[model samples]
Target: MTGIALPSLPAEVVDQAIDWSIKLTYNRADASTMTAFDAWLASHEQHRQAWERVQSLGGRFAGMPAELALQTLEKLPEARLRRRQMIKLLSLFAAVGVGGMGAREVTPWQRLLADHSTQVGERGRWTLIDGSVLDLNTDSAVVLRFDESQREVELLRGELHLISGADAGSPGKRPLRVATAFGLFEALGTRFSVRLDQHGCRLGVSEGAVRLTPRDGTARVAQAGESWSLSAREATRGTATPQEVAAWRDGLLVARDMPLAEVLAELGRYRHGHIGCDPQISTRPISGNFNLTDIDATLDFLAQAHGLRLNYLTRYWLRVSV
Candidate 1:
């Protein structure tokens, strides 16, 4: 049901439907509340459409206890959802008479609502009206908002690389900013890469500079040849090479003493399904340049060179051991 294609409805109407769902399913609504909701539903055809789509979100959790659903939502390792986002999602689930969910599970629907998105193993690039170049890594989604007042890119998921260009609008040089779940990045005519995962948002500046402001921390300037990791609470500075910063642009993965498990995890982003590493070899240091275009060949190389075994449980599932 979550995968059902739905008719497009206005954003406001969708929000209303979600709110109504929460009130009706999660709370003991008074008669007035029910009456108002009924009126809203009957007021417009788009409202009905929005409710139909949002209600499907809870189909899987409909039978679970509320406490159990909440526990499941809290334990989603891959979602790395913030506390606020988690609460909102929980409410959304409660609307459809369920509760447990993860951001990863909901991300596909989000991408469907995005202005730009890429499928698994596929990358994307676009030239903005301001002449800036925007690139999306595999399975990424973003919304571009460029108006007279500002130019903004909202990163919904995965990673993005951008090269800032002069905005020659009437007001001139509208600030180019990228908004992620963790914080905001204001570009300063620079080339930078940003990745959002369960951990946080990682920023690598290859050229010029970028101003990084975590949601709860003070602002700071990140110069060229610097890397920063930002969470909701703070920002940590790090180092990265130019090659490493822009490697994905050239279809290469540069592993600088990276862990075997980590390498497999990165490769998994380019290919579908699961790639598992045995715990014994998970932390083994691996260093090499691998081609991202052909993930299977790289996995084969790693298996033969490192004296490991590849167990193909299915075409969509592979395990590396011994």
Candidate 2:
């Protein structure tokens, strides 16, 4: 799939967009090149939108490390690279825009056409066409690609709880499968939640069973009340109490003796911006059920109860320290 077109964008389109980006930003463009670029835009309405979106990527990198981003930018061919363009070029290198990337990150087109998606701090559930329910966690997305041959759901990001549904159109029960970058999960008439992270996927099963097939190794099956971590190479069986798995759906952030850093990371998902703690406090373990809907109030109360200081650099940047 490396050379193949992204599910949301054609290969030629991405190549052409990249070419245009380079011409306008990195390379000197003559009058003829400008005319040709305009002609390309006239050729397809999407080309114009692509150019706009590409030009808009630099601001996202403002917080990135200067040395790391600059080093990457210096490798580019741009003679006079602006700060914003550096980040935009970084995005290009990381396969953020257009295609060339994996299926984990949802493309712009996918989001526009996604049957169901959620924004930061927002959660939702969708009753699928086949009568099953798919619950989306905060800042998540999933795409449904069902057909006469198979029923499949692709997890783009974040987490989801998928309950197997009945497809009346099929003679037998339709096979329900969830796909992610780490592996493929096939449901055996059960209920489960899948969380996508940087390295792999975490799966929690409350009822029934699921078989996980890693990209490079043997498949492993977890029974009801079981959990597992799936990487590209293997599935490591783990434990996740059903309560912990379903707590988010109930508007609570439940952590049981989990490290303070991880707890903050979980809380950060429901709130905006940088939420962190001092290195000395990072290892502290916390256990509680906090409100998810009103996270700021919860954090404020917890700061008082835990004898911690809530530091706010700005409305978006927050830190909890002892």
Candidate 3:
């Protein structure tokens, strides 16, 4: 649907309106809650406008019954899923003044709103307030949470390389940690990289040790020169060498006699589209260091080196055949 552009609303106002909607509509908030909302609505005209826009947004949710605004959220998981729904609602609010949120653009809302993030094919490095160095891989997002208790990096999406700083040695004695969907990794003055995939979180430790605690499993210490795949239940050792694993930090993809299909899959993550190999050649061995800074050129080089033909239905859809 074409959006009707209205006067731009403040992000905080939109969020407040959404929070109120969630409490009032989904939570069955009490009379006292309603009274508080009333006072908030009357405090400023912008609040009223935000409410109107929220109501209008509800109308847009009519057909898509799964959205939080129209959901019977009482039946859903309370903590993580609830926050996920709220983010989804916020994304819808953001899409209002622009054109409708396209199907392809739905998943990146949280990433786009993160404290630190990189777009597709982009890599970035940053220094945290606590003097730590952070390197974000393509399509990555992270949020920092620092307090007296701990210094935490919340990996919302994609992969990251972190070198723990001296925050732990400070007066408050805060420990440094990284949180992923599967579990938390507490650093011991370590350098580590974490990548999230469908199965679980993949961790590569190069410097000091880190304590790995799965959400529902026992904690284990991952020592230097170790790579682990941590799911909610267990931590499995990975086979890749330390160099092959961390090569992306130098803008390279190191395929150590990796399968052709596997190579393509890794390359696909750095690009916009599907990169597939013919089934017959999918298991063929490929080995080399390729430049990730230019993916198309890398693909062309691979095709030449491997004697594979490239078929392109569109620039975004590519297939490799023998």
CA displacement after TM-score superposition, residue 6 of candidate 3 (Å): 41
Candidate 3: residue 259 Cα off by (Å): 1.3
For residues 79-139, what per-residue lDDT tens digits would candidate 1 score against the true structure?
A: 3344554466566664444322211133365488789898878889999889889999988
Every model: Cα RMSD to truth: 15.7, 15.4, 15.8
Q: How close is candidate 2 to the true structure, as a TM-score?
A: 0.68
In candidate 2, the residue pairs with backbone N, CA or C atoms under 3 Å apart (3 or more residues apart, or in different chains) clash, namely: none
lDDT string for model 3 (1-322, tens) is 3444566667678678777655543332322343456557657888877765555453344334445543533332221124454565654544432223221222476586699998768999999878899999987889888887789999988899999887644687588899988999999888988887755888889999989899889898888898888999988888875557778999999988788877887887687644665565767899999999999999999999989989873455466777
Off by over 4 Å in 2: 1-113
Off by more than 4 A, model 3? 1-107
Which ten-residue region of model 3 has the weakest summed lDDT? 97-106
Expressed as tens digits, the lDDT of each residue in 1-322 for candidate 2 is 1343322444455456656655443322333344455456547756644544444444344345656867755543321345655555665544433322111122344356577888768999988888889999987878899887778999987889989987876877778999998789999989999988867889999899999999888999989988889999999988667668778989988888877767777877776544666656766778888899988998897788778988863465465777
Name the weakest run of 10 consecutive residues (lDDT summed) in model 1. 98-107
Error of 1 at 192 (Å): 0.6
Model 1 whole-model lDDT (C-alpha atoms): 0.73
